[model samples]
Target: MSGFEVAGVVIGALPLVITALSAYKQGKEVLASLRKFRGLLDGLIHQLQTQKTAFYLDILEHLREAMVPEILQYGDPTEEKCVGILLDAKTGTQMHDYLGPLHEPFLEIFGYYEKYLKEITSQLDYIVRLKDAPKDDLPNIIRASKIQNASLVFKGRLKFTIDRKTLDALVKDLGTERYSLGKLIKRVKTKREWEANEPTSSSTTLTLAFARVRESATLLHKDSLEVPTITVTETCDQLIHATARVQVKSICDDAQHSRNQGRVLALELMSDALGLSEAKHKPHQSYNISTTLADFLRDTAQDEDARMSPLNQTLLALNVVSSVLQLRPTVWCNIPWNSMSIRFPIRLEDDLRIPVCAPYVELAADANLLQSHTCSPKFDHDSCQDDHARDGHSTVGDITSQVHGGLGNKEPTRRHGNIHGPDACCHLLVGVEHEQIIASPCQGD
Candidate 1:
């Protein structure tokens, strides 16, 4: 090789070597930072187990022993004064005259305390739900609990980031409010008044109140407000699961008792159809599924309401027929194969009969709305009339008849155009090619 050429190559290699060394150093620094961050997380998990856990337990203990019993004796948790607590309602404008300027502060304190008490109860309930936890549900519950905690952490972090005064102010407000409640409790006049103030709906009130308590706790804890890393999370979860198994039997028993009493573990809105008429002047219309319908669903072992519990997709369809009918109110003619209304119909009556005849038509789901599921759409090219003729599937004619409830072979004549009348009733009939809708206006006696 030429001497000049070898010299050029050596000179070029110097910058390359330097760059590589710099990249290596940068990578090492990143790894070291990650390790340090991990150590912080480990300490956090330990703190959650030792100090924070005990602190939360202590908070609950004070609330349970001190506040809860007092509120129970008072009846209305919102009541600001002893007289109001005894009365079980608002103290009227008379309160404004007496307490005057202090009334607003009293009311403010009452509201904040109520919210704080609620958070405590919610945190307690969440803990209670997990304490007698099963191995199978522990992982899922932990994940959910983490989500709840994140909300708290965000509030605490906000407080910490802003100023020291926010925390101090909150503490002062809480203390003053608690003292007010204590004084109000002592002002009860008669035994009869106390009895009258008893909580009419204790269970619902308790559940809602506890939810607020957990919310408050998350707002208060600043130092431990950061989200735990996977290592710390898993460690904390392990600790909880280890301690939780002790009361599993009792928790299971409590759960079972709650179930038998028709306890609602949760409630979910099945579809937007539930509140579809909100803008319509006829708000809270007669179209809702009532308690009578719920009774009927239980009485008849029909699997029409697929989302109804136990047989159960936790979310129940509010109304099956109206929902389907509402979606295609304009298309009143062609029964669209791809409409979601067929699957998620608002359930009304227990008389729902699922005809296996028609194939479920799936439309393309847009990503912006929800992630699209792979759909194997069974497309029936036939008109609505022909769609129902298949074996095992109820014919359109039969479905229409069944919907009529044997009122008469005399069906209401199909009417179209803006329906404005005294009493409006609409029935939709799906045929192979089109859905024939019969609308009739009624004259009430």
Candidate 2:
């Protein structure tokens, strides 16, 4: 071959060799990565499967114990039956007790209402056939039917007719079967007023209010708005509180049930990487019950970021409340009057910021950087007087003296960085972190 031809061949061969080497190196690296990834994935999958199995077993066992009677009672309506079973758990009993006197009576009232609705539909079955009748006439029929037993009194300007027998039946059911919620409400209010008027030495009114809050929380039949207003601060807050209580209780209950299942689900999940699943093997116990089905499914997935949803957040809140209440039952038994406001933490809407302060807590829409903190030194709104802060801190004394009319609050001024003393009313460590909203103190502070 000529010199030019030989040089061309050499250059072409060099490039082909280089390309082959590069391809070989890349192939080896890719294979190594795949092996590493496969091992990791296998470990993760095994871990998840172990956890998934344990969680189901633990919760299922608990459900089996808690739900037997409820299952039998509402067997035909599976959803209702499951709910009843959940309500029968020890956690459920704890919830009822926390609610105090409100629990049994509220459930009883709800039971009556359900029956009432059923009875209404049964009595009004005539309307389904009388679909051809004047629509206006149907309202009158329903109204007349409802009032025959004097069960309902319509104040609005509306006219309707009802067959006499249906009306009488409706009235009779109201008078005999249903408890008078109106009367119960009136009695509660009356008791409240009497307690308010009584001497401070008697804590009877506070006790009554505590019971009322519990009762309100358990009221299943009330409108959503009413439920929050009764016990929680804002509507959203009430929802959050309710939801949290439920979920946390489930997790705890599930943990407890895991013993019979050989290992707790949460711990089993951790063991997959740790290799606990291989250590113990037991007969697969069959469970007829399902507890926290939503959580069980989600936990087995590969996605690590997939967490308990908003519903789960609610459950967490409820569980936290339950845990706190179980630890401190007396917290709800009495009112802490020293604080400026009382707010129960509940989430009603997304992005709603629920405050831990009292109902009267307010922030003016237009104000400078104003911060409110729960203070120390027993800050009862009614008892505070001016000049209380000036007694010891002489540095700020000049400012006090220069003022023509003194500052409104007598509770000691909390300068920045002041360590809270034991006597501090709010027991709050006031800082930029604790402050929420730029609020102006009300006239009374």
Q: Which candidate should be chosen as best, given TM-score against the real structure?
A: 2
Q: Write the per-residue lDDT of candidate 1 for residues 44-81, one digit (tens) a residue.
A: 22322332233223323323333333434543332122
Error of model 2, residue 317, in angstroms: 34
Q: Count steric clashes of candidate 2.
A: 32
Put down candidate 2 lDDT per residue, 68-182, tens digits, no spaces.
4443444244322333344344545533443345445535654553343334333222232122443223223333433444433322211112344554454445444234434
TM-score of 2: 0.16
Off by over 4 Å in 1: 1-110, 114-159, 177-179, 189-445
Residue 315 deviation, candidate 2, in Å?
A: 37
TM for every model, in the order presented, reads: 0.14, 0.16
Candidate 2, superposed: residue stretches over 4 Å from native: 1-103, 123-167, 175-179, 194-445
For residue 422, what is the lDDT in candidate 2?
Answer: 14
The number of the candidate with the highest lDDT is 2
